[model samples]
Target: MALCPISLSLPTLQYFYSEMRGVDQENEVNRILGAFKLNPYEQLGLRFDCDASALRRQYRRSSLMVHPDKCPHPRAKDAFEILGAALKHLEDPERKSNLDNALSFAKEELLKDWRKATKHDAGVRLAASLDARGMEGVEAAHVATPAFAEAWKARSREVLGRAEWRRRRMSKRIKEEEERGREEHRLEKQLNKNIVEHEKAWEKGRTERVGTWRDFVAKKAKKSKGGPVGGIKPPKRLRALLRCYQQLSKARLSLLVTATASAGYVAGSREQIDWVGLGWTTLGTFMAASCANTLNQVYEISNDALMKRTAARPLPSGRLSRPHALAFAAIAGVGGIWILAGKTNALAAELGAANIALYAGVYTPLKVLSVANTWVGAVVGAVPPLMGWAAAAGSLDLGALILALGVYFWQMPHFMALAWLWRADYAAGGYRMLSLVDPAGLRTARVAFRNSCYLFPLGLAAAWLGVTSPYFAYESGIVTGGLMLCAAKFVSSRSTANARLLLYSSLVYLPCFMLAFLAHRKPNDVDDRLELVMGHLRSLGLFRSGVDREDEGEEREEDQGRVAAGTSGSDGAQSIAPTPGASRPLPPLSPPILTGDFWAGPMVGGLPPRGAKS
Candidate 1:
């Protein structure tokens, strides 16, 4: 047998080695896919304590084994990518340090657990006794035992699992915080960009704005020289007076206030209409409103100059001086209170004074301070109707309260719509309105809608309280229902079109509702109603009896005898002679005496005397 072993061919050995390498790559891909995903060290099959070079070498080996081109496994690509990511994580100094700390902490916990168990376990104690005689430390020798080694492995895995979970949580939290910071920074950058663009645009238009203002001034100057007024040029004094009127008050709003006062007076009147009283009440209310409005413009001059809607106002446009405006307000205020106190009652005068103070003192300053100023403004709007009622009735009664509350509630939807439509202007003017704060308009819409709903019940309450007939409720329901629908549409769309629709609806609703109320007004006299009640009670024998009834019968007989004697005279004529001891019938009731230009009208026939024939 001296022929010896035959030499293997090099190509055959290379082919076999290639087959083995392919099988090894497939196996590594499976192992990587099966490893714990949270821990990068576990995925790469590298120890947590491994240095950057060692980690890099292991990652390279693992990645090559699971490379998609080399491995036949379907998940080879995923394993290769995962191995690359693990290498990147371990390469970072901070990440590597955190992992090392986690591993050290896990090892320390495992040793502590082991020592605690060994204190009670006989087998672990025997292992520790043997370690006492050996060169290794007792804890290390104990960990070398099969039982302690199994426990240490489990405890280390558990501790590393907790550490990985904490790291994932921390990473998620940090990412969220970074995202929030980036969003805030982006918004700030956009805001600054917008401000710069706005300033640039304003600067570009400066020359045009100045030219337009000059043209306006020239036109005004020409008008003062001699311009067409009501188809004919007026005298200088007349023009100046008209200009003063325009500067002192808003005519349309003042007229609306006077109309509301007239409505309240008519509603509250229980007897024949007091047209003279109505005139005085309306005039006084208008003057007070004008005073308040002028004071408001005076206070908000600087703020008004910023808003496009208010920039052309008298005070802001420099058409009216502050001192002149103040003087006008003072005269209007004093004159208004004087008229109310002298022509109307003291209560109406006090209410007028208080309303002026509320509007100019409290509401004006509060406009820039709080969103609640809108509600305070509603209260100011309410006082006019109450003043009218007090002027006619000489007291604040339940009917007056209902009328005032209607005005109060109506203003919410009306002004809320206006506020929403002019939110940008309000913001520019530095006023704190609800619409300005509620960017989405949810709150403003809710407020408007809620107040509109209140109108429905208020109408019913007015009828229930005998302020108006039941028919007014039906009419008011239809009107307020439309307002509510408009409000709801605004809430749904939050668009300018919907808000404008709501505003128009509110404007229509007030006039229609007031008209309906006036049409269905219950105008029964208080004295007549009270007399009827007393007569009914007496008929039921609840009031008078015996001697009182006899005295009433004798008085009735005596009145009948006098009437018969007067009628039975030779001529069929009315008697004008006064009885010696009989008290004369009370004179016809009339309105309080008027001074100055006003004169009391003759008393119109009302209900007949209490016991007289109809």
Candidate 2:
């Protein structure tokens, strides 16, 4: 990733045609020139007078070239990176020499590749030069041009190809040998089967003889014996989901579109997930959301109990066991992928897994550890829509990213106001938010105002790029920006009243913006924003809007009841009504539970919530 420019900032004759990938342009060219190795303008391929005019002229051309994104060659890209890093280093006068030193090192490496290539060519030409030396003399025998270098490279290629072939063949032989050993072991097991069978037969005969002798003896000696041993039956909970939920955070689950929901409008109004293509993305989103919500419970259950607003939650209320909570998480996490795999494509499944991992693995823990978690959570929240986009498009869509980023950036103002309102509770609960940082709400208010202000530029880009319609642009600008301004001027700067207004505005802004974005019915627009939204809605059926348990319980119960009644053919079988939170009543008491030594199946049913990595 280091892109310090050296002499070979441009494609060095060495790796230019062979290795250049992201580093192929002036973007890198200018970057390399500025950051990597520049003692003076003259040194960086410039002829500037020691004046501002010449320096500005050079800066313009340089800037155009090393724009990073503009680069066409792999080396150019590398150079651009180097240039940027170097610039950052040079920005501090104290660090300029350090950057220069690093650039020098990078340039050396680039030159090394180039010179070695040239040297190899020179060595190969020694033979031809010798032949010429015999025919004409030292003067006529010399080869100075790039032709000699090509000859050397050709020979090198031929030699390397042979070596690669030999290596591959050796690798194959080694693998085959290992496979043969495994096969022999399998054959050995087959051969031992007969011996084991003979031993079983012998044991059976011996047991029969012993029983007969013992019975004969016991007829005269024994009178009575104890009947049976029994123990109280333990109450059963759904183990699979529990186990899955426990193990869920690490497993590959399907896409759950739950993250965007908490985001309120953003979740709803954002483009649709292609149910057919990106269902797993929805699964991931759900896993992330579920994980975030759950982790909040895990870390703040005690704190939540102290708060009147949160005391009714499963954990705080003691309605849900921690193990059960863990298990539920596991189930939801892995089940995400399981459901998605069957319903959508492979990519969706992977995205779901990734989302769970990020949310559960990274974001969750961060809540207990640092304030940065909110930002990280925001990032996790944004990924679901992207996943939705990818699922529908079968590729990455910029529109999805634009929408996601708009939401991500918007979180600052959106959450700051919330943080301010709940600062006291958050501090009491040990939750870090902007309000916690600034108890008076000054800093939190400012951040909300600032982020709301940024929505204009971000929203404008989305509008101009056709990610959404002009309607969204105007609406979002008025809603987000206006609210933020109000909070800053009236609420943020004054007592908490206006701050509350700002927070309310933010809550309103998010959902309203998303709704407006969704409402944009631009006939001429090429993006399938509406189509994707409709598709996901169709897949989710009528309940897409409300995934809350209260809303879903009845529907789930009905479906399970229908399936159970149809399947329960025997009248004598005992059954329990739906377990708490389960779709239906527990299965009849006859079936054996899959657990301990008797339990055998896949370790997990589906993908778990994504763990955080980046």
Candidate 3:
């Protein structure tokens, strides 16, 4: 039977009551257990050797038996509370260690004191028996012998108890180390299993993700196949045709020609536009530009291969043969001039052919030979607008020249900036540019600035020549002044940044100034001629009845004075109100300029001189 801690001492019961007396009796058993003081393992009905789980199991059994509701004993609640506290104390490593230390110290002290008392008692008994058995004369000698025997017996028992305690401790330590090793091996196997499971999960997820990506690609390909390019492979001939077309066109630069041509057509024609003629002119210009561009590429293929900038072009990259390129150029060049001559006018056709000749024949070879190539290239670029103007009017005129000169001046800063940026490339390609030749950029900067200076006078000349309104003089002054300022900055700095500013200013000035000139063009001459015709018609009606037209005109001198006073400012006002009694009773509408006929009529054969013919 196990010795119960409670049964060992009646003082223990009293001590337990004393500890529990101050604690709240009305509290739950667990709370009471937390405050309770008792031997934890003993309260749980476990030996000190029991493991944590055994302690816990014994605690549960004891708690169930001593529970206040089930046992119905006065001490049952206390027992349950104590049992809960014991379980907690034993479960906590720190509290359990303190309890074990106290128990061990108490056991050690008790054993030491018992050894002293036993030695004293054994010495007294042995001495008394020795005194009874020995002769009276040997008492002193026997005294030391009995004492030594008792001390030896007491020391032997102490040594045996210490050896037993040490043996149990060593056994416990070995069992604990073996248990720890088994636990570590179990954990190692578990970790390996977990790692394998994680890898499997990762691979599965990766496979799913890859499958999803493949599905997306397949869906995209299917969708794309149903759309343009259609899944079917293009024929070799068709591919070659497309590749050749792209290489020959140089679409972006051709658009500039188309734009200037449109501007020129607007500036040249006073009557309604001829859309069919304009279309032919644009198409002709595009073909001319395309032909020139292809020829230039063909001629420069070897040089292009030397420059990084041009090395990837179709010709230099060997994507298209020279024979194919030459054939395309010949066909486009001849075809473009023929279209212009047949559909537009001889002057436009000649300008288109000249533009091609200058760009390909003169400018292309000139690039390698001389820096003057830039000037020739600018002249070439300026021809498109002239072509358009010629196409519209069937001849070159002041307006056409003005438009062309504006384009010519605009390219100076534009090309100079580009040349400065690509000077090294141009050097590698053996092209002579001002940027490369001057090195200091002084000449290039001066050229750009000088052209900007010329642009202002050119703009004013356009206004003075009656190509645009006087407002254009003022507006163009500001625009040109800004461009000149940018050029001046480039001249002073000779920096790429300043050059870029000048270049961008040129780009902005060209289109804006062209549009401004087009927007504010002088009102059609047809208006004044139409007014003269209307006046003549009114005079004819008076002539039919033999009325004196001269006297009627003289009578309206006072009315004319009043109208002139009202209209005589620099406002460009036109007066169409007839002198009083000069015509029929119909009130004059605004001048023929206001009527749509000034702008919307079919092309006039030619303007008749005033008073020359109806």
| lDDT of candidate 1 over 262-324, digit per residue (tens) | 888898887588888889888898898899989988998767767787777767665667898
Candidates 1 and 3 compared by TM-score, better number = 1
**Which wins on lDDT, candidate 2 or candidate 3?**
3
> Model 1: runs farther than 4 Å from truth?
1-234, 524-614
Better of 1 and 2 by lDDT: 1
**Ordering by lDDT:** 1, 3, 2
Ranking of models by TM-score: 1, 3, 2
lDDT of 1 at 116: 71
Give candidate 3 regions above 4 Å deviation: 1-232, 235-244, 523-614
Top lDDT hit: 1
Off by over 4 Å in 2: 1-288, 490-494, 521-614
Q: What is the lDDT, from 0 to 100, of the residue 342 in candidate 1?
A: 98
Compared with the true structure, the alpha-carbon lDDT of candidate 2 equals 0.53
Model 1 lowest lDDT segment of ten: 594-603
